[model samples]
Target: MRGTWLRSAWVMALSVLIVASLATVAAAEVTTIRWLYPGGEQPVSQQTWKSQIERFAKVHPEIKVEVIDVPWDLAHDRIVNMVMAGDGPDLIQMGSRWIPEFAEMGALMPLDQYFGKEKMSLYYPGLVKTVTYKGKLYALPRAYSTQALIYRTDLIKNPPKTWDEVVTISKKIQSEHPGMYGLGIGGANHVSTLSQYFTILYTYGGRVFDEQGRLQLDSPEAVAALKRYVDFYRKDKIVPNPLEYNREQLPELFSAGRIAMFVSGPWGGRALGLPPDNDRIPYASAPVPAGPAGTATELVSDSTGIWAGTRNLKAALTFLDFITSPEEQVQRDLIGGLVPQGPTMATRPEFTKNPFFKTFIDMAPHGVPQPQPALWEPFQEVIVNMVQSATLGMVTPEQAVKQAVQELRAKGLVPAEKK
Candidate 1:
C-alpha cells in the first residue's frame, strides 16, 4: 500500500510540471505594447478605455496592450525624460502643436509607410496637415476641434454675421440685461487666449508666419485684429473683466447667466447639458463673425504616434489602426465631446443632425491651423502676453504688436526683413 501511494504522488508531480511549462510557452507567444495616454484619467474615461482594450484583445489575441494614463500638465515633461533616456512607451498621445517639437527630437517614427494615400485620405486634409512635420507624417489625428459662437437664443434672435454687428449687438444686449455682460473673452495667460486671438487674426488676413515662414505679427492686419479685440473690453465695455477668465471659465460663466455669448468648441454644448437633439438647450451655435478677410476659426487637434525605439512596431501599428477606425473614432467623439475627425464620421446622423455639432462641422472648411514652432511654449507666452498687455491698458495695440515682434526677433524665432 505504501508503494502504491508513492507512485500516485509521482504522477501528480509530473502533471503539475507539464501544465506550468505550457503556461510559460503561451505567455512568450504574446507581444505586449505600452501606450502613454494623456488627459483621460477620470473613472468613466478609464472604464471606457478598458472596455476598448478588451474588445481589441479578443480580435488580436497575440497582442497585449498596457495603457498608462498621465495628466495633461505633466505629460510633456514625462515624455521628454523617458524618450531621452531611451525608455519610452511603444505608443504615445501628442498635441498637434507638439508634433514639430517631437519630430525635431528624432523620437517619433515616420508613419508615411504605414499610412499611404488611401488610408491617409480618411482624415480631414487640414487635420492631416497639422500632424505632418517637414514633409513627413508622424502621427494620426485622434481628436479635433474648431471654435464657434455659442449664444443664448433667448437674448439675441439673430446672431452677428460681421465684426461690426458683433459689437453693436453686444452693446444692445448689455444695455437690455441689467447685470449680465454681453460677451465673454479670454484674456488669461493660457493657451485658449492664443486660440481666441488667432481666430480674429486669421479673420483679418493676419498670418503669424508668412508663406516663407517669416514672422508678421506687426503687420497691418495683425494690428487691426488686436485693436478691435481689445476695443471690446476698453471701448464697447460689452465684455466683462477678461483678465479673470480663460476659455474653460467662459463656458461656466455663460451657463450661470453671467454672459450672453462666448466662443468655444463642441464641448461647450456638453457643458451646458445640450443633448444630441438640442431638445431643451437655450443656446444656439453660429459661425464666428466675418471680418475684412472673412471668417476663420482656430483648428486644434490631438494625434497618436509610435515611439522610434519601440520593439513591437507591428503590434503598435495594429493598435493604431484599430483605434482610428471609423466606428471607434465616432464613439470617441461622442464620449469626449470632440468634433469628428473625418468625413465618414462627420456625415453620421449623430453629428450632421445635431444642431450644435452641425454648426461646427460647417465651420470646418474655414478653419486655420495654429502656427507650428519648435519652441511653441515660449512663442505662445509672447502671444498671450501681447493680448493681456493690450487689454489691460498697458500699451496701445500698435506698440504691443511692435514690442512682441522685437521679442520674437531677439529670440531668433523670426528672420530680419529683407531690405
Candidate 2:
C-alpha cells in the first residue's frame, strides 16, 4: 500500500510539471509582425533585407516578421487611401514631411513614451527628429540618406569650400575640361530632388516663411540666393544644355568625367564607372558648403510608422524596436544611403567608418532644414517651373520669384510676409 501511494504521487507530480511547462511555452509563443515598405529593386529589398529580418527573428524567437513590398510610385496614394479606408498594414513607411500631416490627423501612434530610458540610445539624431513632429514622435526611422557633395575629387583636386570658390572653380574647370560641364543637377523627380536646391536658399539667410508663418521669398537674401542658382545655369553656363537634363542623368555625366561636381544625396558615390570605395577614381563627399548661416545641410528621412487604425499596433511596435536595434543597423541597413532611425544606433562603428558617409554624418545632426509645408508638391512644382522658366530665359529670376509668390498667395498657400 505504501509503494502504491508513492507511485501515484510521482505520477501526479509529473503530470503537473508537464502542464506547467506547456503553459509556459504557450505564454512565450512567437508573435507575427507584418511590415510594409516602399518597394525597391535593389539588393537591399530583394535578398539582403529579408535575410536580415530572418536573422533577427532567429535571435528573437518570440517574433516573426514578414516584409511586404509596395511599389514606390504608388506608395503615397496607397498609404493614404488604405489608412483612410481603415484597412492598412500594421506598419507603413513614411517620409519626414509626412509626419506632421499624418500625426495631426491622429494617423500615427506617438512613440515618445516608448523612447524612454531603456531604448533611447539606438538611433541617429537626424533620424529621430524626422519621426518627432510637433514634439511627439509618431514613427521611427529605419534608414536615411544624408546630403553630401558629389564631386570628381580627382579632377578638382581641391574642390570649392564656398559659393564664390564654387564659381571660380567651375569657370576654370569648364575652360580646361573640354566637352565637360563644371556642375550638373537633378531635373528628374523634382519631388525627390527639389529640396537639394531649396536647402541652399535657407543657408543663404533666406527664409521661405517669416516668423509669423508667411511667405518671405521677396527678401534680399532670398533674391540673392535665387540669382546665385540662376547664375550657375544661365550666367556661368556651367550646367549642361538646359534641354538635356533630369535626375540621375548627372551620374552618367559624372562617371564619364564630363562634369566636375554636383550636389546630391549620398547615393551619388555609386555611379557606374566610379571605382568601388577603396579603388581609385572613387567618389568623395562633404557638407553642402556654407552660405550666410555657415553651411546648413538639409535633413531628409526614411522610417516606418504604425498605419492609422492598425489592428496590430503592439506587434508593429515590436518589429520597429527590433529593426532599429544597433545589431540590425550594421547587419542590415548600414549601406551609404541607408541609415538608422534611432539617434544613437546610427553612430555605431558600422556607420562611422566610410569616409564619404562620415563627412555627411558630421554635417547632418546640426544642419537640419526647416520643415516643409504639408503641400510640398504644389510648392515644388511652382519652384521648378519658376527655375526652368528663368533658366530658359523666359523670365528673369526676379520675375520668377514674383510670379511664384503671387501664385502662392493667390492660392492662399502662403501668408503675407512681415506679419
Candidate 3:
C-alpha cells in the first residue's frame, strides 16, 4: 500500500511539473509584430531596416518586430490581399495616397488616441495633410520627396527657370548632343506617371478638388493643364517613347546619360551612383521649371501605419512613434536618400551644406501634397489613362478631359455639373 501511494505521488508530481513547464513556455513567448516594410527584397534596404528593428528591440525587449520587405511594385496589391484575408501585418509602409483607400476599407487604425494634434507638429504640414482622413490621423509620415529637375550641367550652361526655357534648352541640348534625348518623360499606367503629370498640373494652377472636396477635373484650369502636359510629347518631340517609360525608367535614363533633363526625387542620386551633394557627375538638380502660375511640384511621402485589425495596437503605436522621432527619421532619411520631413532635420547642416539637398529642402515649404481623392487608387487609373490617350493621339486633350469628367461622374465620384 505504501508502494502504491509512492507511485501515485510521483505521477502527480510529474504532472504538476509538466503543467508548470507549459506555463513557463507561454510566459517566455514574446509578442511579435510583423512589419511590412517597403524595402522590396533589396539586400541593402532590408539590412538597414533590420538594423533599425534590432535597435527598436533593444529598447522594447517585450515586443519583437519581424520585418517583411515588400517590394514597391507588389506592395499595394499584396497589402490589399493580406487585409482582405483579415491577417494583415501589424504595421505597413504606406504611400500618402494610400491612406484614403485603406481608411475607407477600415484597414488602418486611427492614431489620434496615441498621437494627438500636438504630435502632428513633428512633421511638415503637407505630410500631415496626407495622413489625415475624415479628421482622423491614420499614419505618420517618415520620408517625403518633392520633384526636382535634374539636368546635365555640361549640356546646358544655364538651367531653365521657366517652362519655355526648359523646352528651348532641351531642344538645344538634343540638337547639339547626338544620341541623347532632350527630356526623360513617362506616360505609362503607373503611379509615377500620374505624379509626373501632377507637378505640371499644379504648376498650371489646376486642383483636383475645391474646398468642398468636389472633383474639378473638367475645370478650365485642369483642361488647360492637361493640354500643356500632352504637348510635351505630341508637339515638343522632346521625350522619346514617353508612352513606354515609368518613374523608375526616367532615373535610369538620366544616370545612363541618355537624357539631358529628368525630373525626379532626391533619391534619384541612388541611380546616379553618387551622393546628393557630390558633383562628380555632370548632373545637377534644380527646382522643376515654374509654370505661369508659380512653382509647383508633387510631394510624395511614404508613411508607416498600423493595421486596425492587429491586437497589438499599443505595441504597434510604440514602434510607430519611435521610428518617426527626429533621430530615427534623420537616420532613415540619410540612409534612404529621402528628404527630411521636419525643419530641424531639413535644416541640418549636412543637408543645408549640399546644394542638391538644399534645393529640395528649400522647396519643401512650398510643395503640395498629391491629390487625396477618396477614390485615389482608381482615380490614378483614370488620370493615367486620360494622359496616355492624349499623348498617344487617341483623343484630343479636351476630349480626354471631358471623358475623364464623365467617368468620374459615372463612378459617383463627382457631380455631373458645376454646383
For residues 71-188, what per-residue lDDT tens digits would candidate 1 score against the true structure? 8778888888999999998998878888877887888999999999888877888888889877899999988999899888888899999889888898898788788888899989
lDDT of each: 0.85, 0.68, 0.81
Candidate that would win on lDDT: 1
RMSDs, each prediction? 2.5, 5.5, 3.9
Native-referenced Cα lDDT, model 2 = 0.68
lDDT tens digits, residue span 1-419, model 2: 99999999999999999999998897668676666777644565656567767777777777777766777767767777877887777887766667666776677877787766466556555456666765677877665665667776666777678877777888888788788888876544356445655667767877676534567776777667777777877788887764466655777777777787877666666655454353545567767767777676666776778876776667777777776667765555544355444556546776687777677667666456444454555666777777677667888878888898787676555533211
Candidate 3 residue lDDT tens string, 62-92: 7888877878878888899999999999998
- Give the winner by TM-score: 1
Q: What is candidate 1's CA lDDT for residue 363?
A: 87
Candidate 1 ranges beyond 4 A from true positions = 1-7, 274-281, 414-419
Q: Candidate 3: where is the Cα deviation over 4 Å? A: 1-29, 275-281, 414-419
State model 3's lDDT: 0.81
Looking at model 2, how many pairs of residues clash?
13
Which of 1 and 3 is the better model by TM-score? 1
